[model samples]
Target: DAGVTQSPTHLIKTRGQHVTLRCSPISGHKSVSWYQQVLGQGPQFIFQYYEKEERGRGNFPDRFSARQFPNYSSELNVNALLLGDSALYLCASSLGGGNTEAFFGQGTRLTVV
Candidate 1:
């Protein structure tokens, strides 16, 4: 089976712009696997959706949003991008909820200028 995959591996945007990142989980997974990694920090949870419903969210502002698709893939959208939003956005795939082991993708590196 394929591991989780994310698109555009890298991006660059200006403040106030919007961006969308994509993710596809392992073949049979049905959960969310989204996180943000800063220069020297651990991954920060962003969103988690299971069975097409939102199950968890982190302390991110409303500028961040996401949805899991019927096929188990997901998309993360960030509006009004800020310089602080520049980071490596990661995605993972799990069998069910947060407790399950997850497989991660290469991540999307967004650089806000």
Candidate 2:
């Protein structure tokens, strides 16, 4: 059983360009969440989708968006990219709501160059 898988482990984009990051959750997992991690700082929650519905969001700008598919796969979209957006985009999956243990993927390293 795959814990969590993220594609295009690395990405290079110029400012103002849009990018989409993908993730696949473990079998039987019903919740998928996205987090942004910048070096020297902790991971910040971006979005959480449960059963295909968004359940929570973080203090990120409107440029960040995400959605979960019926199969439990997820995608994180960032629009109008900026150099500050360069970071590791991580996806985590959990069984369900309330105190569930989450599992994370390797993360996509987005570089704004």
Candidate 3:
């Protein structure tokens, strides 16, 4: 079984720019969640999508948004990026949104200059 996968591995952007990070979930998974991990901090959930519907969201600003595709892949779009937005954008997948253990990708490290 293929595990969750993310793209770019690393990214660099400037303030006020936009960036999109990608993720592909494991097979048979229906829930995908986006998280941001700052240096030395735990991963903070940004959004959770299940069955192609928004299930839960985190405390991030509107600038942070995401969507899951029919194939269970996902994309995280960050608009007007800021220096504080520089972090490891992690994507996790689970069978459902309840309380299942999440499998994470290596992450796309985004650095906003």
C-alpha local distance difference test of each model: 0.93, 0.93, 0.92
- Positional deviation of 100 in candidate 2, in angstroms? 2.7
lDDT of 1 by residue, 1-108 (tens): 578889989999999999999999988889976899999999999999899999999999999999989999999999999999999999988998864598889999
> How well does candidate 3 score on lDDT at residue 29?
88
Tens-place lDDT digits, model 2, residues 3-83: 799988999999999999999998998999999999999999999999999999999999999999999999999999999
Question: What is residue 21's positional error in candidate 1, in angstroms?
Answer: 0.2
Tens-digit lDDT track of model 3 for 1-113: 78999998998998999999999999998999999999899999899999899999999999988998999899999999999999999999999887469999999999989
Screening candidate 3 with a backbone cut-off below 3 angstroms (N, C-alpha, C), the clashing residue pairs are none
lDDT of 3: 0.92
